[model samples]
Target: MKRYYQQEEDIGLFQRMQQDDPLAFEEIYNRYFLKLSNTAFKRLQDREMTEEIVQELFVNLWLKRHRLPELKQPESYLQTLLRNSVIDWFRARARQDGFAAEMLAQPDRQIVNATEQHILYADLQQAYESTIGQLPDKCRQVYALHQQGRSVADIADQLQIAPKTVESHLLKAHQTLRHVLKDYSAVAVALFNFVF
Candidate 1:
């Protein structure tokens, strides 16, 4: 009985999403977003980052709707993806923060063109802002300040709050955006091309 229900739901969602039905996508989001966000938050221990991760994942899933295979268990697949994304996030953070300098210090590093690098950075920034705009008001403001290259102290000063409050808001906003923009590479690339 359980398998039958899962199969039915998966088939319905897959078909509806393939047809570009917004309601179908909403159903999928409503069903999976919070659960996936929670899973990511547990692993990352940062609410804003987790939300952004999950959002990207779902957005990708929607964009790739036509290619999605029939899921044996949709919930399980979402959870697994969240777990993997969180791990990848931490790995990237470590690399960016110089924690993995030894691995990245290879002499054969291929240098990218300055123009292309700038375009990519700008594209990412645009996508990040678009994702942040989808958040609640407070989350959006906090995220925007962070993206504007403001430090926690600066944000606190601007908002007239404690530094810890800024940190907390940033944490929540990051998680929300992560979950909201999960799997957003395709959209980001498209937007990048459009702008550049």
Candidate 2:
């Protein structure tokens, strides 16, 4: 009976969100943010990345409120969205060479032990390197510097470009890489410690 009442309340909040009620959205976010953050953190094991995944989920939820379909269970809907967001992050990480390093640094490394997994990793690694080589000179330069742990301001100063410009280049590089590697994510996410 209490669960049913909570579902009714959640459905009402979803409807209000579609009508642009910031308060309703805040209520939903407040209710779910910690749960979603903890869910993502358990899989990601990285605080910053988990926060990014959860924040982006809420941002997209608010941005696409009007288009969201009616939900019998908003919690389920949010969970599905969070799952996809985590997978998307995995895809982005797979495109970066540092992904290997990050995985290796994990105390309990989930390295590719199976031949099939190794093949997939090798293919993705090659694709990532190729994609990096194909980026526009400026975008590639900004991305390489950023990967080396340079701050946006530092990269901007070194490249004689605005910080915003540096960010723009990095965003472009990431978008391109994500697009190119999207197909491999479902498989890659499963083979790695990204299991939910």
RMSD of each: 16.6, 15.5
Steric clash pairs (candidate 2): none
Which candidate's lDDT is highest? 2
Q: What TM-score fits each model?
A: 0.48, 0.50
For model 1, the stretches where C-alpha displacement exceeds 4 angstroms are 1-8, 106-196
lDDT of 2 by residue, 1-196 (tens): 3343345478898998899988788888888999899978877889998898899899999999999987986877887788788877776777585766676677355454345578888888787889999999999999988765466998999999999999999999978977888889555734342321
Worst 10 residues of 1 by lDDT: 187-196
RMSD of 2: 15.5
Angstrom error at residue 137, model 1: 50
Tell how far residue 158 is off in model 1, in angstroms.
Answer: 57
**Candidate 1 lDDT by residue in tens digits, 49-147:** 978899999888888887877775576566556666766776587568874565456434423333555776675777667776677776677667775
